[model samples]
Target: MSMTLTDDGQTFSAGRWPLSALSVASAVLIFAVMQGIVLSLTGGVFDYPLDDPYIHLALAEVIAQDQYGVNLGEAASPGSSALFPFLLVPFAGTEFHRYLPLIWSGVGLIFAAWLWGRLLVEAGYGRAEWRWLGLAAAVLGPIAVMMPMVAFVGMEHSLHAAATLALLLGLHRHFSDNGGVGLILAGAFFGAAFRIEGLAPGLIAACALFLTGSRRNGLATAAATLLPILMFMGFLVSQGLDPLPSSVQTKLSMTDPGDEPGFIQLRLAILLVNLREPGGMFVAVLALASFLMWRATPLKGTRWGVLVLVIGAAAAAHLLAGQIGWLNRYEHYILVMTAAGFLVLLPKATQGAVTPLAIGGVAALILGGALAYRLPMHFFELPPSARAIHTQQGQMARFVKDYLQTDVAVNDLGYVAWQNDNYVLDLWGLASAEAREIRTTAPVPGWTGDLTAKYDVPVALVYDHWFEDGIGADWVKVGEFQLTVPGGFLGGYVVSFYATSPDTVAMLTGALEAWIPTLLPHSRFVWAEGMEP
Candidate 1:
């Protein structure tokens, strides 16, 4: 409760929980519950959403037992991105060690959310606007509901979010308190975030630096903190260990699907509609805040210059790094700061005036959180709808747990592998380059053939609905299962597969034909293998 950790010449204290900090405690509890539900459903599984989660858990487990690297069930090589787990290893002896990330994420989010409100109010959020700003900071944003909802133990995501918040806060403090300590501390956390996701955090920090007009100091601080890490990475490279993957280089080049500028733009635009529509009210508030900042205060010289730099850098970084279509929500942080600058420029005339802005902002955030929670439930499902995705996921997980035989091999199929203890030949292992090759390099005529021939994948869970473009047909659907309703799980079909073998064919085909009607009520199941005739 009263522990201290120093980084970059600054000390960070995990202070004792203050009796007055009940609000923060409550927030943490709420966040924990949300995360716990997902964890429970997934059975503490670490797969899919990229293999980073498994790597983190495996690393923590390895470090907990004081080993260099060991197989964590389904994981291979313990993978790269070890910093987050390394931090937790020291605390691993205690129960809190295992749940360290959960604690940090829950607490970090709450702290960030709380500080955002105070920062806004101090910068210029009127009493009326405080509630809305708080709501916005809590829900809408790049690292909002979705990331936290899925990533309870996901340190990288949470760390990135928390550090981004800290970086923003540090910039805010630099302008308001002329606080060098905050700047240095910001550099450390920001540096760690970059260690996890290099490009985005680095971009965010650069923005923060420009915003503070302390580019020289910010750069120096960042370089100093990151230098050690870089040197370590170089050492690894010398020893023939690529600290990270070429995927990073590809991501930096914006070639990765998610990082592509066009895709980011499209996504950002859609998300920004939250602010853009509804009468341009949020934008109006931002414009007004900027105007006020310019009008009243004698905030000139280093203070104003730093502010300009901070605002500019923050704004540019938002556009450059974040999804372009999500501007409405992604811009939440910048808006908060923009509001602060307005307040500093022209201290609110009356606390009473912000009532409408507060109402508007809060409403926007609630709507955002609601939407954020439900979108993935719907879109990423098999059928692309919420109606049956949850149950469908349950059914798939249950089926795998019950029937999967032989060590399984999959292409980017961590979610399934994580749920059960089958030896998974994960095509998407630590070596993402291999994964890229697997995906882009064509597969054999049937998924089973490809696995057996190329990957020596003995058994597979090939999806049945590739005609619908579900997960692709590089693998064939050897087995089939159906939800009670079509698209109930997601939309299309939730079929199972087994390798092309005499025993597998008979077992899976018979099991499915018998099990399908009983479980789903109005579903059909068939074995595509017999069609060979």
Candidate 2:
């Protein structure tokens, strides 16, 4: 189980594994299966913990019908992933779309482990045989801990994580071996399709290539990453939508722009908060990693020098563009990638200076603490999380599509938007550029009322407090859908039902009148107090 290295950090003879990649693969598979089982028992293969992934499916459904957005005809940029909607095109409206995202998580687990094997070997972490299996788990365990969580969340984050590792491997190979253009391009392409923020790791690698005088490779890297994003953005603009996604705009707007905190100060404060959060261990390890990367490579032409620069550049990017504490989902991929990237450098940094056991011990302790401190899931969180979306939003989508078949205003715009073939006037604006603009940029008088009036929304399913003053008076709460939903899954779990028009009142009332009786056994829907038609 011990790996003996020479002064230059290379082994004189290969061990039993000789880079078999078996141990890493097995570890990843084990975790994937554990997460898969949890997913199956909790809801099924077509289930997800969060509703955001459904937003992509909603867009995919729109694309499937030769249109855009949830309303079918209205074109809008809702999901943050650049090519995710297109990726879901084949199974957009099919039952398989929901299941495929989790599958991608498994693939990411395997592929990332494969890359990790190469990276460990390249960094002289030693051979990986049956004996070293435990060592592999100890060293690479952080990735294993997060992979299943990424999969269950059912976003493109799994792919994002894999793409990031690939880019790191490509950069090291490019510098040391004068190899890896193909790997670089593949990672960049993953960024283009996986998630818009996924571009950071690969784009940073491309810049490293250019900085290291590999201009041809650099150009290819840039083209691969930029082309798909440009195409997607242009398409959105052509359809008269914001180039930036609604998620991006909304998250940025969520950050307070108060005169006291000051914009820069608030972002700085948030940035510091993010580095420490999700887990305190990452910050400590990443700080150690910065020093390790610098020592590992020469400043003039080495990969670590490039890596240090790129990581610093990337941290700045995340500070400006990213947020944390949204159930540890938003910044998960990049954070893990940063930790993994530093691990790659550690072996080289400590080559003759320290023992391999020393490095392994450090990594295991830090990452293990992170896992122990913040368990991504507990059995208690699963049922309520699933029930919230499946029972409430899923039911709401069905009601809007089958029972009412009318445009409605809703704050939570994923499941209903995707499942129902109706236009949802997203009050929070994850699906509507105009709504986001009204909420953020425009100082319009009675903006919410203006939005409702402009859209002519017949029904409104939002939080009770969302519709204030004029807007609240205009709508009547005929019914409400309440469930013992968890707060961790959503910032605040509130899904209400309102009748925006008189006809909507009658339609909802009639449907509830008939359906409420059928739920004599048990159900979550009932008439709003004293406001039933």
Candidate 3:
């Protein structure tokens, strides 16, 4: 459970940490406990804003099948490498997929707690302030601690949070000491952050060099930090893998429009808005105190360098808004920095007086108490469960895997693709690079594929909504299932179904109702054929 790493980078000290062990273990435990509580509160498989528990299930399935970078031939896309997919594959294969999201959530929370605690201690929080330090860290990292459970259901938010904190901590140490392996480790964290999101941390690193007094140290730090990324890219290239045209970039180019305010205003606005959010008010108060602190201290030596990096990074990210549409997730590390930014200013703000710290601590506790009161009591909104939707999709998948025994092509693939072993047309990612290509010179059409390939897909799981609106008509309806019974959302969970048999013009008028006792009664479904046929 515990280990140590020594100066020579070789032996363990008589008895100590192997560097960040306490942080890692604490993170894991915190993540697990939080996950258990949340899952117990909400039944298993809650998928509201994101109705794709199956996406993760699919990723784990791919890894389970022992296929690396297996695209499942759905859409013009490849699998993502955000890490959680690979991490959860075994669990999914073993029917433990329901708990995968919670596992990552736990990991994120624990790491966040550990990082905040250790970083605060290292930043010079006195023993008397440890309780305040813990409270402030939680308040500052509210998003880091909880959002990973809600918004980051499938992605690697926890790892990203941990890495971002590590990067900042390493950067802080680099500014303090300025030589040796710590600098290299700082660079390594930078590299890890780069792999997470290219623009934010990269911009921060670049700006740090420009703003810091040690041009050589800043530049050295930037170079060393980027080394891991460069090496990783090089390895990919060597393996004949084109890391560019990457899933992250391709997805960004497609779904998101690249237009937003400059980084400085945007970053500032984010803090304000986060503060305004029911869950973010405590963070907002801490942010105000932090800003006050930064104003008092400004920047001295390495601290000044770190400030320069923060400002520069924020500025550059804003200026390049035309190219890299600002997705808030990309800037999650800002949570940790804002906390550090406040500390850097603390000494000057207090001016050797204990009063400012005391007032600030009390204010943080009050704000945090208010936020904690509101989130669960008033905003106790939970998403619908995937388990409810899974039955019919699972039944259909079982039919295909057993009786039908043929490949399937779905237009709007979600959990359906993951439950079955059939091939998918697209999996909610790069496969539909239509959105991305349309914003470019050539203006390409998305999903430009030959559907009538050698492999015959006997079952087509199409959703009528894609065609009914006439927004997209690439598919032909072969069959349908309709429900005549008056149906309404039952406790925020809607259950409805439609079935289309192969070559059937649609099922009987009330086939949906007829199969109600048989099928899982999905929120929506359809049976259809591809346009190429």
Candidate 2 — which residues are off by over 4 angstroms?
1-46, 128-134, 138-145, 259-267, 279-284, 292-303, 352-373, 376-384, 442-449, 466-470, 485-488, 517-523
Root-mean-square deviation of each candidate, in angstroms?
8.5, 4.1, 7.9
Global lDDT of model 2 = 0.64
Candidate 2 per-residue C-alpha lDDT over 1-533 given as tens digits, one digit per residue, 9 for 90 to 100:
44544334455443556452663555465555555655564455235667777888888888888887877677777887876567777776667777666666667766766666666556555533322533553344544345545555667776776787787777767666647678889888886667777667667777778877888888889889888788878887888888877787787677654546876788776677666664433534564556555754443344467776676566566655577544455665666566555655554564433456435644564556356435545434643465455655666667777676778887777877776756688877888877777666753544665677677887787776654542545566787666543433653455567776565678778766665543311136756788765
Window of ten residues with lowest summed lDDT in model 3: 487-496
Alpha-carbon error at 211 in model 3, in Å? 6.3
lDDT agreement with native, every candidate: 0.43, 0.64, 0.43
Give stretches of model 1 more than 4 Å off. Answer: 1-26, 29-82, 85-104, 117-155, 177-183, 186-191, 194-216, 224-243, 246-302, 321-405, 419-422, 427-432, 441-448, 464-476, 482-495, 500-533
* TM accuracy, model 2: 0.85
Kindly list the per-residue Cα lDDT of model 1 for residues 34-70, writing each as its tens digit: 4444445444531222233434554555556544332
Candidate with top TM-score is 2
Q: Which candidate number has the best lDDT? A: 2
Steric clash count of candidate 2: 0
Q: Write the number of the candidate with greater TM-score, choosing between 1 and 3.
A: 3
